[model samples]
Target: MARVHAPRLIPDPCSSAAPRRPLGNDDAAAALGPHPGWARLPLVVLATMATVIASQSVISGAFSAARQAERLGYLPHMTVRHTGQHEEGQIYIPSVNWALFIGVLVLLVVFRSSERLAIAYGLGVTGTFLLTTTLFLVYAHIKLRWPLWRLIALGTVLYVVEGLFFAANTVKLFHGGWLPLAIAGIMGASMLTWRKGRRIVMAYQSDVEGPLTDFIRRARNGHLNEVPGTAVYLHPNTVPTPLALSENARFNRVIHEKVFIVRTVPANVPHVAPQDTVTVDRTGADSDHITQLTLHYGFLDDPDVPAGPRIARDHGVDIDPDTARYFVSELTLLDAGRYRGMRKPFTLLFMAMSHNAAVPADYYRLPRERTVMIGAQLEL
Candidate 1:
């Protein structure tokens, strides 16, 4: 039997006349042979599988980053689900996943093909590369102890190359690059608004709340009603007087027998052992009965406020289960207009976020029946 040769459908890379270019589906199929059905099937399946795996990896990374940002106080908190028993990094944020799903659908519908989407993808990749390269320069120079000349040399080359790539991608801004830029803008604006709102709110509270030591002194002298039971007030810092406690005293004129001002600190690591995460400091005189509790959590850990009793007991202050009450301060953004740092549109956005953010009782896993929310109005 004589063999018949099939036509060369795809260009050979080794040939001088065949210029390198992205191969189309048709080219791939044709390259297989005249009867290319079976041969091309595996190739198509492999390519699809690779794409799916890459996409899944990217989505996982996005979830991890979003959760970290939320923990770091840059973004609002979302419910996180741990998929693995021992893997702290295996987290799923429903909101982020849904948003990404919708985003992917919109992109697919709008772009229709990978050719058009590549511009936007390229823009995102280049922008991230530039940002990472910039960070690397700083880390290399300061932390890695690279020589000044070496640092400058490495940074300049990386920056020049990445900057050029970013600049080249900018040409596609109107075509498809606008998508990532718009997303980036929204994220940047959100992060900025949160940071500014937090700063302004904290400063306002600090100015109004007064010193913790002074409050403890006053409380000891019988300034407020010494109510039965332990009162746990969650504060951002170790401020002796928490906003919740101050408000309770000013309005209600009441204080619990043993007052605990607790603050949960987030560590950069994945998981902090429970035993090593709690610190208790007994403040004021023996008669005052004021204690400060600081709980440390890994960036991935869910904060548990109900553990306050256990933590207190570990430090020798036994909290009565029946009498304990958790107090949280809720912010009401008064439409009295904007304040310093946060202005107009962004301020409104921040206010909306603040209004919708998860309540302390829910986010910190406090006992709902024993939690008290005291609302305070703020201008910003």
Candidate 2:
């Protein structure tokens, strides 16, 4: 349909009487009108509405993508608000929305016209197409185990088409095409740095936290004074003892009478089954009153720390949510003066991202009044 009408919508440069103004969507709308009269007004209005709907869809998609990235550990935790009760994908990310708004404002001020902006848009779209095609081909080959000849034939055809599209846009590199590429580069760098930094920080934390089983055994042996309340430690994994729990035992020299080490695991699916949400490990809970609770949440599911206890009760683990005091770790990154693994600038970027990330209490929906943050410093 577009190919059939494009010639009428676009002016021919070879024509001597063609207008000097740059062609755009407005021109296309005008072409769709019956005549240069009242018909033009309605067409323009319709075009405007269509553009608005498209932009809104893009913004909503961005919110979902950002939320998923944060959940999957590709990005820093952001404030995600579910806007729809029945739809798990209906979410709003204020940070992403604001960033997009600012980016659009800057682009409008700099480019000033659709003709100039098209260069960057074309590059971004074509780049995405090329990458998506490559990824699809790779997935088919590796996962589906496509025969070598079939893989080569399909890949050759797709790559040639995508390569041509990408190569056509590369000529506009200096003329605003660099904007999208630069943005992609920065975002990719940030995601990679955050993932790597998280691993390094977690390794350091695990080393410092020692072993969870050992700590539980020591507490069971009456090595520390027993307090009379339930303490819930929110941790990323069940492998290492939570830094908050270890820190509390170290500084206060007291262990809670009943302790629950809770770890919220982000599953690969969109929504985990309600029945499979909470699992309790009572390896030593019956004797020592120390239990290990694992909460499974999908990328779209909310990680409510307070609700974990209620869910655990269904699994035969009794926990009082109202009186449980939640403990979380607040990590402060110290200067890594001579770190060799990650560059200094990337380290600084990671620290800045971590500093701005949503607080654990808010992210996990823990009770603010009963939540306690244990500060810990990590150098490198």
Candidate 3:
């Protein structure tokens, strides 16, 4: 008798259509149940309060004094450092922790005007709260298929909770809470700028890289081009612009005609289970000569998961391996003071430690030597 191992069943990768099913109450109910009256309503409200207030208090009252004192004209000492969580035992700054207690205590006794900052503070905080709640409502209505009344009840509570966070944060602001508000404003602006920057950078990237077809042509004509029955490319979730797309086409000199960009989504809480996969929507004109596939997976999914070529093989789509190559772009980050924070070395180190760990490129069976890494310099 011969020992045998059963081959695993991989999903069909190149299919444009997803598995569809009729809307049944059971599935809808199960989905709706997650956002029950308590979870979405009361429980979320409680968690929100605990999160916002506690965060503000810790940031301001706790370490706030040490940071402010070191900056100001008193006994100046204690340099601010981003230690990068070297100490396994300690979670945060201890000296600052105790100092905040003292500072808040002293503020309570001396500063009678801690209320004025509340108004300025409340605007940003409250607005975010409202926006987040509204987004939740929209998500619930659109995705979960919750009843309108139930959605209202859930959203109303969330809205009210966000309202309270704003209200309370506002009160703190007017009472000499400018720092927190200022910090929030700076953070909000920074986030917006970062998002915009990603767009600009992506646009520039696609442009510099040129279109896949052009790159493929160039590769075919030059060094980058090689024997290729297929090639899979991985991309970040940050969307690409048309300019970048055109550029990518031009730079590549030619395109794989067959490519895949798999992205990993971040999860709020860690849980391992039936990991969902998303197909990346491809742009540019479609030709049987080339096929671009996008896959979306989350952290909960094992990073070493196989995709595309594997799927094609499992699904019986024709693809030749010895000729196929996997292409991955490496993003190198440098800490530039242009963003107004931390040294570049530290940021780069952090990034290095956290490279693509979830999945190795060769997991799909293209082999390491066959893979190509294009170094991409990220905009600081």
Candidate 4:
């Protein structure tokens, strides 16, 4: 069967009518029948459907990767909409979707023919295979505790094969392979810059906010004027006092009667157990009325701010969800001329990314009406 189909599926180089370009799957499909002309339309339709399915998978994978990167602090927070009610992984990221759409348009305009596009696709696939194999080997050694000799042997064999393919693809770098490499480089640099910038900003904010325990001590010492109503401040961690809480106290000269410092922690697992969702600590005595709520969410879990306090209620924390006010800090980046933390270019990129990132209220599904944004400036 293979011998009989070879002539039709693959163009013969010796044949005078052989096409200049290599035969693709579409061509092979069309050539399968006795009459190629009659099978062309059906092959086109099938190819179109296959392309749609492939594109859908790529888009979905991009969304999932973007979300995971954001959660892992490699990328800035973006608006994530959960598309599936039961499946947490089924998410739609508008930013990623639009970016991919624009990229596709640009690539289509730049590379008009599939022949040229194939060069970039070859490099992309081989590069992906090489990196994935490398990562898997590392994971096997560290996480799976594979023997060093076995790992080295397997890795050497895999790397040699993939390296040869990658090297072959690199020969076409100037032709079309440079496109994917350029895109990967840009994305990698952006993610690294964002991660480093965030660390610098976080360190600065930590210094400004001070220790949570010290702030609690101050409140216990009657330093803060008590006001009526419940206030929930969303923080990244329980170590430092939330910037919103500090700013509110500094500007208004008062703190809420019942203050809830909520921190949503991302768990390692896909979905945290329902019973282990929330952990509430009253901070000090019952008279203090200052509670530290830690909401544990898996990477796939939705970090809903408004629902956090309600979840705490089930965990024996007295929180009034109806009348609660949410407080979040809005950070404005200022480039310090003599700043040594990050490079000037990266600082600018980080600032722009930060400006475009989704606000906490919208990202966490907090009620806009009840949410208060306390502006804080950070010099980088």
Candidate 5:
């Protein structure tokens, strides 16, 4: 009690001050200045990472792992998956582990190739990075309403940083980088070819509906031509309309010649044997040329499936859809400015090769022919 009283009377050091806690929000903001900027930055970094990973997934999903590894000299050709007896494209594809596995194996077996792998994959990543920068600049202006000057400054800085990576990746070109570059080229061209082919198909469909339908009606009725034994309407993908057959009947102007609307779609599953099909009657077979309607299927999924009669027959629509007399109305561009870029100047020249290469057949499952070439140029 005495001690307590003494304490009560005794000194308080500077008004009973207590130990201060650790520096937190205010300290950090003071240290960083403009605190929310820190939070915003993590979001931006996360978005960028998502884009890069997604890009890798798309590219890897399309190509095999071993073949992709080959670009950087990871494995010998013998180890790669080869195309089966009937397949056309490259065979050895990649999975997620193949990417890292090869890179690791390369480091263990042959140190030099591993370094090249690092450099080679870097280009694909950097190429996309540059694309991201370019696209994001356009996006920021629209999304954030950033002023022109700020956008330019930010864009310029991004370009410089990303450009450094691009330049660094280019160093690999001398050491087997060209192989991946060529693969990239093939992928880009394939995409363009599919687009051009679709354009022609749409144009042909437009003419088929009205005036073309009328012409067919007269012909079928015998004002213009006699009835053929079979009118097979061929389409590259699944779901061909009996339009061609419909037109044929319209020209005939009488039902009784059977009509066959056949489609050759490609399936995604690899285990699926080449010959797969679904047959159906379009509008209950309004007395057209179709003895049987067979929908052919290709090995690759429908989208990647090329327009070819051979691929079509894999699914069982093995009929001759194109003849010397049969017209394939086609419209394509040698220079469709749609797929434009600095890294892709070759696009301008390659589009010509793609357009001029004899028109691909609407897939219907047969040994495809390469002769028919009908080129149509639409209004620019």
Candidate 6:
């Protein structure tokens, strides 16, 4: 309200001058010259504190969003630490924190001053604003059931304003504005590549491995060497049996007495209750030895492959969690330049990422001694 009425509320000395001079720093200091030290010092401190608070909020928001993205399969998983037991949202990601710290330090060193940094800052802020507006427009139309005319009208108004702001920022493209665009472009490309690469890999695996029901039936009829104790296989698709299981039976010529197929699906919710997280479905009534376990995890929930047996036990499926052996499919991509659609550079990048991704044993919380990785080479 003070700012809205400032022109009328504050006395304007320029009103008395025939040709008014622009207000300078000296004029502002002169205006504040009457304030005592106590008042001035506190005001300056308050402004600094407010700036710090705002920056902290933005930093925290970025961390939270990154973690959520990891859960939704948009990014790789990083270590997450809960800062407070009572506060579920109070979490810290060490990697993101350090990256942000280093990025800010580099920015400060390069820009040297806030005036120079403002050119880059506006691009980041306005770019994010436009993206959020675009996403929300779709969300409102589809999820919120907004009318078509209302959507078009609101979208046009917002796009015009934000478009102009973005265009204005483009004027500073060579003057540090390119930094945010470059960063955004790289990150966006990497994420899209990862998503596409994963889908392609899954599709390839599905083609290689047939349906789970058929595999189970064949194994039962073949009278494969039955090994003692339960064995759990983590599969990408619930319908298709993992190559790991087929490979184990083919090469090793042995199968566990009780085979559990565990497939995890990430839910849209934040956190699913532990009790309702696992749902067990038997592969067939005739085949009591094999069961299909579907694990539903929230975007924030950790997927524990080792927990499948325990969850099965709780639900009256006969199995011991401690003695179960976990089999995980480890793909070795052979880049023969056979893949299409995804560029070769991105395919190579995705391959590098897959090689560096967290090992299934550690990620799934499986016992190091008991967990076995079945490797298969696939040409791409």
RMSD of candidate 3 to the truth, in angstroms, is 27.7
Candidate 4 global CA lDDT score: 0.88
Q: Count backbone overlaps in model 1.
A: 1
Candidate 6: stretches off by over 4 Å: 1-55, 334-341
lDDT of each: 0.82, 0.86, 0.50, 0.88, 0.49, 0.82
Residue-wise lDDT of candidate 4 within 96-160, one digit each (tens)? 99999899999999999999999999999999999899899889988999999999899899999
Candidate number that wins on lDDT, 3 or 6: 6
Q: What's the best-to-worst order under lDDT?
A: 4, 2, 1, 6, 3, 5
Per-residue lDDT tens digits for candidate 1, residues 12-89, read 779987887788988996898677467688998999999999999989898988877888788876767678898767
151-189: candidate 3 lDDT, tens digit per residue: 879877887778777667655555555655555564454
Whole-structure CA lDDT of model 3: 0.50
- What digit string (tens of lDDT, one per residue) describes model 2 on residues 1-380? 45554445666788977778777978987888755677788999999999999899989878877787787798998888888888877788888999899998999998999999999999999999888988987898889888889878988998899899999999999999999988989888999999999988888888999888898888878888988999999888887788998899889999888888888898988788878988888755676888888899887789987887997877677788988999998788888685537989998888889888988888889889999999688777
Estimated TM-score for each candidate: 0.83, 0.87, 0.40, 0.88, 0.37, 0.80
In every candidate, how many clashes are there? 1, 0, 51, 0, 30, 0
Sorted on TM-score, best first, the list reads 4, 2, 1, 6, 3, 5
Candidate 6 is scored at a TM of 0.80
The list of candidate 4 runs beyond 4 A from truth reads 1-35, 335-340
Q: Can you tell me which runs of candidate 1 are displaced by over 4 Å?
A: 1-35, 40-44, 160-164, 320-323
Q: Best TM-score goes to which candidate?
A: 4
Residue 293 Cα positional deviation in candidate 5, in Å, after optimal superposition: 3.4
Q: Give every collision pair in model 1.
A: 212-241
- Model 5, TM vs. native: 0.37
**What range of 10 consecutive residues in model 4 has the weakest lDDT sum?**
1-10
